[model samples]
Target chain A: MEEIIKRAYLESLDGRRFGDKKEEVEKIREKILSAKKIVVATNNQKKFNIIKDIISKICNATITMIDIDTRFADLTRVPALNKGLMALDTETADLVIARGRLGVPGSGSMLVILDGKGRILTASLSPSSIVHRENIEDRIKKEIIEALSRIGINLEKY
Target chain B: MEEIIKRAYLESLDGRRFGDKKEEVEKIREKILSAKKIVVATNNQKKFNIIKDIISKICNATITMIDIDTRFADLTRVPALNKGLMALDTETADLVIARGRLGVPGSGSMLVILDGKGRILTASLSPSSIVHRENIEDRIKKEIIEALSRIGINLEKY
Candidate 1:
């Protein structure tokens, strides 16, 4: 069952398989793991606090919490604003992460991870079951850890 | 040039021609025009103040502002939370209008109008040229009036 799910996930990539290139993934992962700074974009303070607590425990990287509502208030295009914001901070951060609604009925939340160059490295989806519930700190932590692992980032050492 | 731009804009609608049905558009327009209470969703206080001031002068609708940041801070999915919020205030508001980033690079802001049932009645996009600048109160008001006019809501009577 796990293999089937894994295969299905990989097939869903539709030819964009950065994960298939182990060496390249490793290089990017190394750069991310050794980074001095990272930014997480979220409007929810509770989610920010939980993510900050977990990430701080796992790595020594400086994590900045950017409230999407406040930070991008004046900007209309969030993804464009995101790229612009990252471009301004390219000298400081190795990675930037953002999450928001998928905007489709019955669809869930989406997480986007980008490099300093504003290139999307990977994305993950969490269904309504996970996002709509209360007390989801553990689920979010586990999901983040798994997503990082899929991108060749092993948090065991950190 | 103006005629060409209008032609191009109509062409851009393609198959979705809600504006073609005069009766249907008129019905929605009447409902909106007669609405006693309306809610504008935005986090920017300055934008809210400008919208409120303009709307007050144009109609007798009791306008209320819902700060998206404070309102949806606990929820991860904005659209879902929006529906829920509107559902809770169905008795208070006749229409709920939400504005946000369109997620397309170089594109402008999008305004979504939803009924009590959370069904979108109409959507409009304001180009980045108008939305990105500072002190755009008059422009915002003009754009909103134009958007409503396209949906068959003429505020000339008000």
Candidate 2:
């Protein structure tokens, strides 16, 4: 059975841009592989659909998405609460996908993976925010692919 | 100019049921009349759209709905952050309408009004809950009508 990895990411206002891209996804992918349970702290279907597609390719994990009012409910907003909520609900914690702010142009993402108990596991940054003309979706795809490749996560089929 | 009155309500997870029939809607309507801005926290388009119809009869102020994360961003888990995010964003802050949590068999609702700067002008509790067996649409309309009647807001055409 694919392990569950609960994590959260900040979706850009335009529905694009994630975070500091330096080796982030790769590190998160590694954690996702080893985790037994995964939950995402977001209710946005659009965000979930996007994350679901990206994670499935990198690691085979049973992921559940829960929508929390990240915008105004938590201290660091909804994204930060993702880890804490998962730690409380799941049998055991695995990894948390943490992304930095996604407001800069062509800015890569910072993906941090935390343990099931909300401890930092490993981190990888995928730097891909150089191109200005590229669309946000394309940029995100490029960065995710790079991160996965760097961490030896196979996403060729995806 | 039609003063746009944003009606806020809480939807119980169970369904719609309320103990007092007319009194509930009446209360919510009063809140609407005294309000200058409204905020609905849920990202459900259906709910927001339904609200859009109800408020139209009350007043003609500008109505803006707050966006919530669908699958990954659940408001229940992070109510504070969700509220905060709405407050931080300039657009969301303009008109804040938040739903309250009233647990029962029927859906629950509350109405909140904010000023131009997102200040809390007034707040009102909705009448129906998850325990109410009446049709939600009818309940909503009836509640609005009752509320308006109390505040001396007449909507004969609606």
Candidate 3:
């Protein structure tokens, strides 16, 4: 029997791999054992700014950004306008993230997350339809908790 | 001297060209002329619903949609997805309408228009971005406009 291989996309701004060599992930994993803060990467000014703004008020962490093509080319020949794939692909991020907009009476986008290795840790494709709606911060926090659990990262201290 | 031959993508929904077989574009042109409202198609269901809700307050044609695949398969490939193409050719579309999102901000999608006999009329890639936030809608509108103009269709009515 053959094992199925899957590649997960991480969000980063430094480069496609989020400035981490394979050795770096090992060191970071050790820090997670007792560290108060976690460092993660995302793509673009718009995306980084959005994530940083939200995460700052929750738990504290240094949100470093890197430049990379979060868009997965292998999924299809065409590139996805959505940024979730990019955020999840290259970084040492405990979780990848994205944000969408709100419009009309019942139209809006969602914030999605992927794990460090390019797997979709958790996702919200279509969230509530309100511009800058309340509880968005809380919702994201909850999703992060669930995603980390799936990846076997415990956030009990923070 | 031989004239430069251009190419394009023609789109239809559920295999129905917008107009009659003898004069394919006339049906769509007529619809536009009689339409009091127009709603652009998008993958966002919320947006679609909102647009539909507001149609009565807006234009008169009511809301009609066409699905686009930014990843719409290349005509030469197996398992063709082009509705217009099938009507004209076991080979190609009058104009290839792009369906999915293009990754680049201002790079847009493509359209290949064909004559009645499946001859290539004109082919053009749409602008990837709109003047507003560079998203999928802007790209599709830009491509549709260019494709229509090349075919000598008046767009102000649309």
Candidate 4:
């Protein structure tokens, strides 16, 4: 699966070059395959579509894609209580649980989803940035449930 | 911007319900807005296309979308020296620098790209999970440059 995607990335790069085209593609491939979880940071719908669609047609590991960046960055969100948010998104920790620490100073916890491998994924600091602990957990849970349902993953339905 | 995207997620819901549609949409919206950084976790290319294309037409905050999930989870990657990768991706830190601390335990430093508020974006561990420091940064840089080039941002050309 990783290999196929690497090829897709390599394929996406034309002969066009500023430095060394081959070197560039190889470099990109290295980065692409590194993620424990896949969280794409893209803003262009057309381009994203083209790359995924083209690469997907070939055989590879198939997964889900969602639009988290409706207004802000709905790419893939990695929520944390506070500190672990980074640890989680970066593939350092399988899970991260932080509390009372962030821009809001005293925020809550957060989480994101992943299927396999290191769980390359997304991250975000809940709007509850200012919200205290205890209360934030329920909020994050509700939000995750909500996100899952949007994409047809209704646990209740199941 | 958060409001706009919340609506987009809500609008995408279409009142379809196995449970409470309104509640479901609202929950989804809350989750969507929480991310400190925007890393969308999605797999369906077509659905992603429609959401972004339609929503983009409306406009709140425009972003760059790429094929991070080309193979595995190319959605986006958060590279770290050792730790703090999550900190970077989840908007905790504008930057994180780690060394010989990831799955590769002895792996080197890592970094991701971000702009504005928090870096709502993507993340992944390096394939060099076993590789040491010094070597990984150059490799990561090359890969990033390759990625940037693919999107038509050729620094060398510039």
Q: Best TM-score goes to which candidate?
A: 1
lDDT of 2 by residue, A15-85 (tens): 55655354555555556676666665445565556656887655567766654344432322333434344
Model 2 CA deviation exceeding 4 Å by range = A1-91, A94-97, A100-158, B1-60, B64-76, B79-93, B100-130, B138-158
Q: For model 2 chain B, give the 10-residue run with minimal summed lDDT.
A: B1-10
On the 0 to 100 scale, the lDDT of residue B89 in model 2 is 53
Best by DockQ: 2
Assess candidate 3 and give its TM-score to the true structure. Answer: 0.31
Model number with the top lDDT: 1
Superposing every Cα of model 3 onto the true structure, what RMSD results?
Answer: 16.2
lDDT head-to-head 2 vs 4, winner: 2
Per-residue CA lDDT of model 2 for B15-119, tens digit only, reads 454443454445445555555555655566766677677776665556656554423323344332335335435353335554444322133554444444544
Off by over 4 Å in 1: A1-158, B1-20, B57-59, B67-92, B129-135
Query: What is residue A69's positional error in candidate 3, in angstroms?
Result: 18
Q: How many Å off is the CA of B102 in candidate 1? A: 2.6
DockQ of predicted model 4: 0.04
lDDT of 3 at A156: 67
Candidate 3 residue-wise lDDT, A71-101, digit = tens: 3221222122134444443345654455443
DockQ winner, 1 or 3: 1
Runs off by more than 4 Å, candidate 4 = A1-4, A11-109, A121-125, A129-134, B1-158
Q: Write the per-residue lDDT of candidate 1 for residues A1-158, one digit (tens) a residue.
A: 23433654676656554445555566656656665777777656776676677667656788877643533322222332343343334335777766654443346555566677666666666676655584466656666776677786667866
